[model samples]
Target: MLTQHTSTCGKSTGTSTGARPGRPSCSLTQRHLQRGWFSRTPLHCPHRILSSSQAGCRLCSGKKRQYSASVRASSAAGAADLPAPRENLGDRIGAFRNAFWKFLRPHTIRGTILGSCAVTARVLLECSEYIDWGLAPRAALGVLALLCGNGYIVGINQIYDVDIDTINKPFLPVAAGELRPALAWVLVVGLAAGGLALTAANFGRTITLLYSLGLFLGTVYSVPPFRLKRFAVAAFLIIATVRGFLLNFGVFTAVRAALGAPFVWSPAIIFITCFVTVFATVIAITKDLPDMEGDLKYKIDTFATRLGTKNLARLGTALLVANYVGAVVTALRMPHAFRVPLMVGAHAVLALNIILETRRLESQQHSQLAIRQYYQAIWRLFYIEYCLLPFL
Candidate 1:
């Protein structure tokens, strides 16, 4: 028989009334009571026959404590591994700068810079007798105005072509959602306004008028109700007229006016105008090569889609090769004083390089990456021509 009695610690104790030899009664200790070791049942008391239950409870409690500690450690480690909650101001500013640079279309910007500098240099060379140091500031301002115009043109295109770009150029800032459309519109509008204002205030009426016309064409090229880019012939004409004819002729006239010299259709300027016009046509066609998928999906009806990438590639290559060859022949025929070995040699080399690149592109099956590389190589050739124009 067993009887329960209250211990000094206010816990129950089990005593064996029919005590057996060598058997001890189950007693509650102050420590056990304080630890709540006897709170479960008398069978869990350490001195009872079911003492193993107490040991099992202790083991379970120890395991739970270890598991809790491990969970806390893991939580702390996970928090340490996480990225910072917010980017710093400098990081944000740097990212925006990169995106804005892309938004400006670096390739076109390069062409503008080289074309402006080349025109100014060529004008100075042709009219060295009328060279004035004051024209330097005007030339710098001209470049700035052209850059603004370039930005506006490209930015507006990006804004309107977001869906097309998302498919064709997912990396573009506007297409990728890095830049908001409203912000893009504000930037383009500001650029257009600033460019026109700068040209009108500082340059002659000729330059201002030319600048306005270029802006107008650029606007109609991409903006709704006049998106001329939808038509192959219109797009080609616009690109050539704006980039090749207007840019070169307008810059030449501006520089000549700044030098107090009357504008003349110099052999060099005429040759460059014709050469670049053809080159711009090539650019207009080839630029759509890699974008055929998106252009087709959107019914943009570009040359690359209508004629196919292979056909367009061959056409662009043939046009560029012919332009280079014509440049070489033209350079050879110039007056002794106008002839330069650099012009002839450079064009010859560029023609060969372009031919080889086109062949390689065909060999590669005209992959998107190869097509882009070919296009970039053509731009490099464009830049080279500007660099060598002074020699001509």
Candidate 2:
């Protein structure tokens, strides 16, 4: 027989074949007790077998575990109920503004402003007798309209080129996830519409006509079925026509119309047209150098892809050198019109810099940087030449 009773304090005082007094006791052998088997009261201990001396131990242990689990669960629930930390208002505003600026592409914006100023100054300085002082505000409004149009042009390009830009210029707003496609499309459409409206309102019909044409060309350059960017010859012609030829031609014509002068191609206008066309050809061809990877992936037949890289670089460098030489010759020919010494010296230095940068493009990584730097330097030269145009 197994033990079925114990003293009141759970001390083993005797062994008996019958149940204990006042409470039920299980008669179990050492093996059955170790295996957690209870004959009379299975409810007393399901997980843990207990001797007659330790009747209610399982219940007490289960209660402690339940209490611990409840405490942890409540603590977790309380933490989840707390509010999250808030972002600063100023930081949020600043981030949004930065993103919007990147979407505009500040370099091109600067180019538009400089180009407009050059045209205005040329008319104001060279043909002031034709300008009505009362219509000066109209001219300023026309510049603003042109800027909006320029933004639309570039914005659309970014929208279409976002995939390529992710590979070539990942920091751009559209490529970097800072701007959404819908937002980019909205920005371009709004700018285009606003530009057309403003041009029609303040500027004359001539100015409005030219602005509309430029906007159309920009649309054709990036939009599907007519994206001229796919073919090297077409891309070259488009960029050269728009940026080099039309930009100067349209601006000069518009400014002359604003000044109440008949549109006439002055010697100065002809000179700029020819020079910019050649310079723009260099820009058109060389721009593809750093963008080779993206262009190749997208099957864009640029000058860099069609002609070898070394040949493209050499061609671009030679053209840049020629441009500088032409600039020096022009300055010398029209000393009465330009700051001759400054123009000559600046062009010479820019030419030398182009030569050095092109020569440095031997390694792939270095070539990318050198080509991009040269491209940017060319823009800087463009800006400086525009800044000097009023004097001419």
Candidate 3:
């Protein structure tokens, strides 16, 4: 006969049929089984014969089902908490933009824009009454044309200097393999044509001719058969003529012509041209200092290669200081033309910076860094000159 156990789990629960006298109490066993304590055990009824392994009591079976369901729910929740992976559109666009800007050489672009703006501002100031407000868009287009031409010149320079640049400026587009030569040529040609066309359509013969001449010189400076860059003197003259004389004078003249005004040689224009010419000469000569290795390897006769780095540095430093000094003197003498105090103070600050930078260049560890920074500083001064031109 089986013992009928009145347990807490349920009434009329059967006791273990094969239980020994010293086994756990029936009530305790029922409570443990109901709580899923025997969940890991094989499917069988604890109260039935031990041989009947297929027989599972309802309470234990329900608990086993509940445990499996909880485990599946937990796994599903964990998966839901984990975020899915995806690409960021903004990051990709930013990367592409940075690469394109670098390829364009941001420093040169900045100089081109600032210089064009300066000339345009000076022209407008000088011939304010003559300028038609309707021609504002045309003026904007002219500036864009100038920028394209400047880009073309720089692009061609990089294309031809790829080999030398690999050693001297490996980060440049061509040398770094970021821009293909064929594509670069297309850009150059397109920019050159667009620039000439825009100038001819909007401005007149004076602007167009000057732009064509500048482009011709730039081509001669870089292209084969008449690669002026191979000759230090030719390169220096070409750079100085285009940047210092042609750019300032031609751009101003062109703007004035667009306003139907006669070209006038103002004191400000003369002073600026002189300053830019000297500045460009200094830049042209000193630029070779950092590229000495590649220049020597390629038999390029740069100022630094011919004159030596130390001599070139000293000469450039002196010339730079002199440029600022001259500017200060010009400002003081032509008080009616320029803000005397502002111009004098600006020049004095630039001269002092060169003095400080020269001292830092003496330190061997910091020489390379200081020299590069000083080169950029010269460009900053050039940009600042244009920014202040409106005041003058």
Candidate 4:
């Protein structure tokens, strides 16, 4: 019971996770007056954000949608005036066609693609004479689980960051008024349900239990009462450790089942899991650096808040470097036949990218955005996965 409860409220801090939205804190009255009702009145939300914890403001929702429609209409009118009606119609049709084909939902599409790739890779890797084709259902569940999990996280992000996101990332769908935050929450529930159903369609109790835990924890981390964003380090640990390590474990299990291979939880897997988890933490730290201000206002205790921005990035780079060293040491300890040159090459590329980025950081020249995304260009970890799959 304590384990389930402490997942949100820190064991040390016991900070309320659902007190408000975002950073979650004392109420308006509580902030000003500790006790005694002094003409108590409903606190009016100036931004009209109506945090998910509150009884939602229908008027605010309607006004926001109305304002959005007007802006869209005005923008359309301006474009229409510039172009001929026939041309504009043709352009609109083309844009819609492109969007539909590309599957314009960023998080949804990315989740689906990555999930599909990971599962497909696992299945192919386990095609040895010993493994069975029976593991298909399990592999498929992993895909659904990842997708559902992604949507829940994105939904939570949009719902809480409506104010900050509007300022920092206006392009975000909810903050930009392309979608209402409350409606987005509905979509989150629907997606999560669909994902769970898909995962459980033919799975056994073991797989079902795993998926349930993953879905529950991921969703809980996003919802209002928990709002794990306030505890960014905790959020990082969950995503980096549980999500990353368990994802690989699930994939490895499915692969072992399919290959009919011995399924011991090998040290190699442990090494890989630690490397992957640390790498994710590094990415999380980099992301939190630029988001420090938004996090600070909301009382989110991210790496940047705990450590300074430059220090956090530097620390992340150091961890990345350490990860490479550990990977090399682990690889050397492995049987020569299992030691793939491809793995070493992939690690080298990633390490070099980290090193260059770190040097740039030390020089104090690169912008925060560059630090956030530049390393993605290398994407060495994924390339390493491609090599590892062939070996598996």
Compared with the true structure, what per-residue lDDT tens digits does model 1 show for residues 128-220?
999999668877888999999999999999999999999999999999988899989889999999999989988878789999999999999
Worst 10 residues of 1 by lDDT: 1-10
Which prediction has more favorable TM-score, 1 or 2? 1
Which regions of candidate 3 are displaced past 4 Å? 1-99, 364-366
Which candidate do you rate higher for lDDT, 3 or 4?
Answer: 3
TM-score of each: 0.80, 0.74, 0.74, 0.65
Best by TM-score: 1
Residues 21-97 of candidate 3: C-alpha lDDT, one tens digit per residue: 44343232333434443343443334542222333343434344444444344445555555777659997677556
lDDT for 170 (candidate 3): 95
lDDT of 2 by residue, 1-392 (tens): 12211222122334332323333332323444334334333424333665434533432443444433433444455455557678799977887688778888887788778877786777767787876878778777777887888889889999999999999889988899988899888888999999899988876777678788889888888889899888888887877887777778878887787777877667666766777778778878888888889999999889998887788888888987998899899889988767788878877987888787776674544466677876787777667767766665
What lDDT does the true structure give each of the candidates? 0.81, 0.73, 0.76, 0.57
User: Which candidate should be chosen as best, given lDDT against the real structure?
Assistant: 1
User: How many clashing pairs does model 3 include?
Assistant: 0
lDDT of 4 by residue, 279-311 (tens): 667666666666666777877778778887667
If ranked by TM-score, best first, what sequence of candidates would result?
A: 1, 3, 2, 4
Report model 4's TM-score to 2 decimal places.
0.65
Pick the winner on lDDT between candidates 2 and 4: 2
Candidate 3, residue 83: Cα displacement in angstroms equals 26
